[model samples]
Target: MNEDVSDGWAASAVAWIVEQGEDGDYGRRFVLDAPMRARIEGRGFRNALDVGCGEGRFCRIMQRAGIRTTGLDPTEALLARARELDPTGNYRLGRAETMELSAEFDLVVSYLSLIDVPDLGAAIARMVAALRPGGTLLIANLTSFSTAGQPDGWTRDGEGIPRFSIDHYMEERAIWVSWRGIRIQNWHRPLGTYMTLLLDHGLQLRLFVEPEPAGGDPERNAVHRRVPYFHIMEWQKPA
Candidate 1:
C-alpha cells in the first residue's frame, strides 16, 4: 500500500464509518452481501481473513456464521473503530503486501478493497500465501470500466440520460476520489491485469460474476444496470 493511500483512509476513517452504517452502501446491501454470504454458507470454512476489512463489518458477519475471522487493515483508526464495535473480534494492523501469515486461513476475502492497494501484485501474493491449500479467495472489486471513469464518474447528455465514458483503459495509475467527505486514492488497472495475476499465482478460478443490483430504489438500480459497477470472483488454491 502507498503511504498516501493509508493516510487518506486514516483521514477519512470517520466519514467512512458513518457512510457505512449497520448495513453498507447500495452496492454491498443490494449487489454483494447476499451472494458473498451465500458463497460462504455451509462451505465448512473453519477460519477466514478479511483483507482491508474497514470497520470490521465482514469480519463480524463471518463470526456470526461461526467462522473464526481476523480482520486486517493498515489504518489504525478504522481498526480501532472495529475493535470498539466488536470488542472480542480479532483486528490486526497491517498491509496486505506485508501480511505475515502462511497457509493459515480457510478463506481470505477482499471486499471492495483491492482498488486501494497500490502494489497489488505483492498484496495478491501475500493473500494467496495466507490461504491454506484448497482454501478460497473471494474478491469483490469495482469494474475496470467503473474505475476508468474516475474523476468524472457519470454524466448526463442533453436527453438527461446518464452516460459513462472511458479512455486510456489499459493504463495503470492512481486516481484520487472523494464522496461524502471520504477522500482516497484508488488504483485503476485493466481487467486483464487482475485476471493474469490471480491465474499466474496458480489459483484456479471457481466463479466469476458481475452481480447486478437485486433490489433497491428503482432509479438507482436502473443506473447500475446500465453500467455495472462491481464484480466478484472466487479462486481456489490447489489442495
Candidate 2:
C-alpha cells in the first residue's frame, strides 16, 4: 500500500465529507442512486466487500437488501462513522490494495472512491483476490477519459493544475477536477479504460450501465448528461 498517498487522500476526502455532515452532497446523491440496488439484484451477490467504504451508507443499503456487507476504508474517522452506522456490521481500517480478510465475498464493490487512489490497478487486483471464485465485481464511478471517437467537452486552466476543473484531453477523455485547501486532484476514468483494466485482470465483463443524469441541481444535471459522470459495471471472476 502507498500509505502516504492513500492515507493522505483518504483523510482529506473523508474530512471534506464529514464537514458536509453525514447527509451532505456526496452522501445524498451519489450514494443513494438506483444503480447500486440494481447491481445487487443483477449480479445475485449476497455477500459484499465495500472498498473505500465511507460512512457505511452503501453497506447499510446492502444490508437492507439482504446482502451481508463488510465496509473497508483507509481513514479511521470514516470507519468510525461506519461503525456508528451499523454497530453489528463489520468495518475495517485498511487500504484497498492491502486489505487482507479471510472471507471471500460474493460481490466486491468500490463506490466513487477509486478515483482518489494512487494505483487503481493494484486496488482492483486486491479486490479480485478477495472475491470468491466466480464472484461479481461491481464498480460505479465517473468516467474521466474519452470513448470511441467522441471528443471530450471539458477543459481546465493550467494555473489550477491539480485543482478540480473541467478538462478535455487528446483521447476524448473528460475530467472534472476539484480542489479544497489541501490535496487538490480529482480525475475520472473513461469507459474504455475501465474495460481494458477488467480484461487485464482476467475479469469477465458482464454488464455496463451508463446512468443518465437523474435529479440534482438542474444546472448540474444538464452538465453531467453530456459527460459519463455515473456508471455501474458488473464483472465476473470466471467460475
Candidate 3:
C-alpha cells in the first residue's frame, strides 16, 4: 500500500519475470494458477481485470484460455515487461488504491498483489466497483497465518526444527521480504480484515481453498502438509 513499495517491485521486476514464468515457481505451479483457472474456466465471464498483475503472467494465462484480460499494475518496469511478453495484452499503468474503469468487468482478480497494496480498503472498493452485478472477484493471497508470522522466519529448536509464530493477528504491519535476490515489502492484515472488506461491500463468499502442495519437494513444502501456504477465495457480487 505504500507508494514507496513500488521501488522494491521495480527493482525486482526482471528477477520476478525470470523466477515466476507462466508455469514455474513452487507456489505458482503447485498452488495458485490451477485454482485461479478452475474458478475462471467454466464461468461465462467475457472480460477480466487483473489488479496488481505483475508482468501480466496470469493475465496472459487467462487470455490464452479465451478470457479477455487486462493486467493492471503500479510499477512501470513490470508493466513494460508484461507488454514485451504479450504485445497484444492490455497491460495498463494503474494503482489498486486509485484504479477506475468505465467498463464493468465480469471478473476481477487479485493474485498475490493485495499484500503489496497499502490502501487496501480503497483497493477493495475499486475491485467491487469494477465488477458487474453478479460478477466474481477472486483473490489468491498469503494467509493470515503466514503474513502475521515473523518475517525473518521462525524460531528453530536445538534440532533446527523451525516453528512459525504469529505475534499480531489484529494489527496491520509491514514486513520486508528478501529471498533469492528478490526484495519487496508485503502488508500483513488480520484474516477478519480481508473478509470484512469484501463482505461489507456485499460480495458473498462462494469458495475458499487453503492449498496444499500439488507436487514439489516434500521437505520444502512440508509447511503446507500441516499449515496452509496460501488461500484462494472466490467471492461473488449478488445478481
Best by lDDT: 1
Candidate scoring better on lDDT of 2 and 3: 3
Clashing pairs in 3: 1-116, 1-117, 1-118
What does candidate 2's lDDT look like per residue over 169-238, in tens digits?
Answer: 3343223334453342344455566577779989998887777655667766655555555567888998
User: lDDT per residue, candidate 3, 180-226, as tens digits?
Assistant: 87888899999899999999999999999887777778877787766
Rank by lDDT, descending? 1, 3, 2
Candidates in order: C-alpha RMSD to true structure: 1.4, 5.5, 1.8
**TM-score ranking of the models:** 1, 3, 2
What are the models' TM-scores? Answer: 0.96, 0.76, 0.94
Candidate models: Cα lDDT each: 0.91, 0.68, 0.85
**lDDT minimum window of 10 residues, candidate 3:** 1-10
- What TM-score does structure 1 among the candidates reach? 0.96
